[model samples]
Structures are given as structure tokens and as C-alpha cells.
Target: MGIKVVKRHGSSFKDKLYLPAIAGGMKTTLKHFIKNLKDVDNLKTMQYPEVQPDDLNERYRGVHRLTKWEDESEKCVACYMCATACPAECIFIEAEERFDEKAEKRPKEFKIDLLECVFCGYCVEACPCDAIRMDTGIFSFTGDKREDFVLDKKALMKNERSKDLDND
Candidate 1:
């Protein structure tokens, strides 16, 4: 059977004039402007850098960081799970056979292109050894060069939030 579509009639006189809509928008703008002007302190905006918001949620997924073992060794076994799960393909890892018998493999070169990362937390979830996490509380990053955005193993290890591991 064919579908039947019903079309609505033309706009009313007020809708055609568009004056009522314009007036409504102006009224809202004026109301907010006056209210804000009267009590400037009531404004929700913060003087960032100097005054940061205190209410950062506990579950806020900030930036990626590699975890370290108790002996200060990299915990990642370099299974490529994180890289596989990364939708943006920002995670890059190179596995190498470990010299130590205890650990079979280790990451020779682990890198994450922050510029391409979507911060979906999939990498964190895919990690089997609890090696990767996004709990640095560092959402903002700036750099002069493109290479600066690529987080190497050293940088990832340095950025580790130990407190986040403790919480886990």
C-alpha cells in the first residue's frame, strides 16, 4: 500500500509578519541582559586559569596515561588490545620480547596521537592488564609543534595518575 502524507495549511497573520517571534527573542535577550547587569556576580562564568571549577566529576575521562607496577616498571604487556579498540586509531604500540623471563612482552614504542584521539575511553576498557587509564584530569593540552601532541612511552609513564590506580 502507498503511504498518504497530510500537509499543514499556511502560517497565521502573526507568523507571516514574524514580529511576534522577533519581539519574543528581544524580550528574552533584554531580560537576561538586565538580570546579568544587575547582579554580575550571579553569572556562572569563571575567570579561568585563576579560578577553575571545583566540581569536576569523579568519572571525568581526561587524558590517557600508562600505569606502572610497584617496582616502577611499565605494566603494559603490549597485547595491542588498546590499539585495537581505539576507534580513532590514535593508539600506536610496538611490542618486543622482554629480556626478563617473567614478562613475555613489553612495549618497545608506545605512542598516542592526542590530536586524533576522540577520548572515548575504549582503550582504557580494552586493556586486560589494567595497564592503560584516562584519569590524568588533564583535558586541556597545548603545544607549538605537531610532534608535541604525540605522547610517547616516557610521556605516558610520566603523566600517570597514581591516585587513580589506588582508587581502582
Candidate 2:
């Protein structure tokens, strides 16, 4: 037996009219090209670093940041909740017991590697004490070395949104 191929229907009127459809598409393309060529400056493109868009909203997750007080004191209670909740496992924290005339457990070291972070915002959401925050509004983070992206307590606290924990 011989293999066979069959077509039940012949080409339709629309199939025969492909050239006009192609011409119509080209016309639309040309119209856009002419319009863009005439007003190239009006194109929707921004010169980054030189010009940037305003902050989108409070919910915009850009960078990972740990909170501090006005006195440059660490706001994190070192509950390990943020670290546990972090999907990327980018957060590192070490809690220590301290006495402020009253004994309390607080974080001695808190670090977040922004390079490894996915900006999921789970840390901020999981914080029960509102100890951590990502309200710096300074979203852009770049550095040459891998260690540079590891944001420590000092760097995170320096953000404008963070208060001075030490003085407070």
C-alpha cells in the first residue's frame, strides 16, 4: 500500500487575499514608523540614572533592608523569623542577650545579602514586632565584589527611612 496525503478543501477567497493583508500590515508598520520618525523624542523611554520615575507606592518591593532606630540602635529583636521566612535564605542574624538595666534578647549582628535576595518581602511581612522594614526608597544596589552586596547592620541603618536607634 502507498501512503497518501489529501486536502479536503481548496484555498479560500481570504487565503487568496493574503497580499492585501500583508500590505495592510506593512501600512500599519509604516504609519508607526513615520509617526515615530517624526516625533522620535516623544518615544516612551527614560534616561536612567540621569532621570528616574517617582516612587510607585508603599507596596513596591525593591530592596531588602533591616530597620534601626533614631539612635542607630538595631530594631530587630533577633527572633530569627525573617531569616526563617526568607525563601532565598539571604538573611543572616545573630541574637545576643543584653541588659539595659533590664535584661533583653536582641540582635547583635544582622546582615542581608542583596545579591542573593529575590526581593520577595517575606521578611518584612513575617516580622511580628515591626522590627524590620524595606522603606528606604533607595532601591538601586550595585557593587563589584560579592561581599559588597552583603548589607550589614551599619549600611542598612544608614538609609533615610531608618531612624537613629542609639540616640532614640
Candidate 3:
């Protein structure tokens, strides 16, 4: 096939003039302004910081956390699936021999570098045991130094310490 340059009419009266384009744009703006002016109380804009929004959806992936059993023991079997599946390679785990009857191995040292994490949730999906989750609903996190963001087993577990998890 060959490329063809076909001659066509340059511009119509409406296309040549800038007034119609400007008026069309202004109509949308004016409509929204009028609607907002009338429905001032029903605006979607939240006065953040003072009023915390509770609009996070069910599937919203926030921060990572290590889940625990009813007895407050860690559910992770130290299988290294989460670390293996992490695209950022932020998850680090050290396995140790567990004397408990529930599992043979447990994580001696579990760490996740939040700064390096991409929040892809691959680690949560890869775990055979329902150990790791990203349902803390805490997207806002801060750190003064590089080391501050590196969360260990204690920190990950602490994410679920005070907050009540949604059973659903």
C-alpha cells in the first residue's frame, strides 16, 4: 500500500473562527460553576486534615502488614514466597527453626523497605499462608532518614496492633 495525500476543503466558517471553540469551552465551565454554586453543600471536595475521609474502597491497596493468628502468633511459615515475588526486592526474611507444632520454620528477621516498595501487592498474592496483607489503609507515611522506612517484623505487626481489621 502507498501513502496518499488527498486534497480536501481547508476550513468551514465554524472551524475557522475561534469564538465557537472558546464559547464551547466556556459553556462547560459555566455549567459546572452554576451547578457548584447551587449545590455548594454537596460538593465532593473534602476539607482534609481536619475531616478525615472514609471513602477508601474495599480493594484499595494501602500499606503492608503481617497478619497474626487468634493467639497473637505470626501466621507466616517463612516460606520466602513474599520475598521471591517482590518486584522491588524490598522484602527480606531470615528463617529460623520453630519448636512449635503449628509450623516447622518461622521468620527470625522479616524486613520490608517501604521506600523501595512499588505497592504492587505481589508479595501478598504470592504467599501460600494468608500471612501478609496490604489492608492497613495507611497510604500516608513519612520518614526523616533512609533507615526509618525499613520496617522489621515488629513494625509490620504493629500496623495491625491498635487498628481493628475489617473482617470482610
Identify the runs in model 3 with alpha carbons over 4 angstroms from their true place: 1-3, 6-38, 161-165
lDDT of each: 0.88, 0.76, 0.88
Tell me how candidate 3 scores on lDDT.
0.88
What TM-score, computed on C-alpha atoms, does each candidate reach?
0.82, 0.71, 0.71
Error of 1 at 110 (Å): 0.8
Q: What is the Cα-based TM-score of model 3?
A: 0.71
Query: What is the per-residue lDDT of model 1 for residues 1-168, given as tens digits with 9 covering 90 to 100?
Result: 899988664467767888988999999999999999999988988898888556666678887889998788899999999999999999999999988655899999999999999999999999999999888888678999999999999999999563533455
Model 2 backbone overlap count: 15
Candidate with best TM-score: 1
Q: Superposing all C-alpha atoms, what RMSD in Å does each candidate have to the true structure?
A: 3.1, 6.8, 3.9
Q: Where is the poorest 10-residue window by lDDT in model 2?
A: 159-168
Can you give the lDDT of residue 100 in candidate 1? 68
